[model samples]
Target: MDAIDPVVGFFGLGLVAGMLRSDLKLSSGLYDTLTIYLLIAIGLKGGFELASRDVTALMLPTIVIVAASAVTPMVAYQVLLRLGRLPHPDAASISAHYGSVSVVTFAVGASYLGRQGLDYDGYMSVFLVFLEFPALTGR
Candidate 1:
């Protein structure tokens, strides 16, 4: 093949690798447990830093963050559809996932913010969960 189609090649290679694997698989049970642990760790770490900050100053930014987080996906979906030629539902779904930043990103960002003497609202942590789960279950 002169040019490998990335999406097809990814799954093709994955299927071959799975068939060839010996004992490197992690069971679904363990993967779920790891995910839960990771989420809790991020929440705890964020909560601790949030507790350290002055709560009074973050109220407005917290509201702003939540609104921006929700609305950004719609904007992204339009861009992807018009510029990238993705279909409507596909673009919207993917845009939602990307717009909702993940915990690891949040965790690293929160750490940076704290180190830089900036205070962020803790409820943004809750908003992250809301953003990801609904999009997932809706599909």
Candidate 2:
């Protein structure tokens, strides 16, 4: 999909860097700064999109999103352990990475849909925020 171009491009850049044994690395402070900036930007966007919407409309979807987020990592862990035969810690780590929602992907998809003149709800961003935490914690 057109939405995945940036993701693929970045992945290619990282792969090339690794293959070349490049010395490029992000400092801890810089990493932390970028992480905070991205998180705040996404949160602010989602918050503004959600501010005027009805809370009652979001309640059921929020419950479902949280529940699915809690369950997905467990299922992924089991599959990685049993089928892939990965070590427990490796399986768990991979599952956690796979299970978490990618907010960047959501933003890109939303942008693509907008460009294509498709309609979607603003509450979907709220759902993306909802789907972030429980997957990593396996709560």
Candidate 3:
């Protein structure tokens, strides 16, 4: 409960701001800067974790995750096109979005787990980075 209070509070703050038509907004440059900073920080932490581990220990899991990332978009496209009855272009666009990783979600989940005193490999951040390219390129 304590771990999630800040999240809920911020969400409520945002909701109130929106309802009041608050003029506060993030500039595009600030948004891009924050995004790059987060990516670099995550990558640096992952690199440090990987540096202390045996490479071969991670190879199999890395390969498996990359392969799955590559395949996700195609499966999503098929599901959207066939089951959702969406047109080809719309399905492709939506599937691409579905396939890519959400950095915010990853960060939030990691933070939550840490707050709960659960253990996880920080190296998983490396996998999250790897997931982006294959999902975006479908290869």
User: Which candidate wins on lDDT?
Assistant: 3
Candidate 1 has what TM-score? 0.56
For all candidates in order, the CA lDDT equals: 0.68, 0.78, 0.83
Q: Show pairs that collide, candidate 1.
A: none
Q: Candidate 3 residues 1-139, lDDT tens each? A: 3545554445567679999999877899997997898789889989999899998999999998888787888899999999999999999999888778888778767777777899999999999987886755644
What count of clashes does model 1 give? 0
Candidate 2 overall lDDT versus native: 0.78
lDDT of 1 by residue, 13-78 (tens): 656878988365569999789668768976775577678777677667666765676677878888
In model 1, state the lDDT of residue 12: 63
RMSD of every candidate to native, in Å, equals 10.4, 4.4, 3.4
TM-score of each: 0.56, 0.69, 0.80
Ranking by lDDT: 3, 2, 1
For lDDT, candidate 2 versus 3, the one ahead is 3
Candidate 2 local lDDT, 33-137, one digit each (tens): 966876687678778878978888889889988888878888999999999999999999998886787765676677667777899876677788788867445
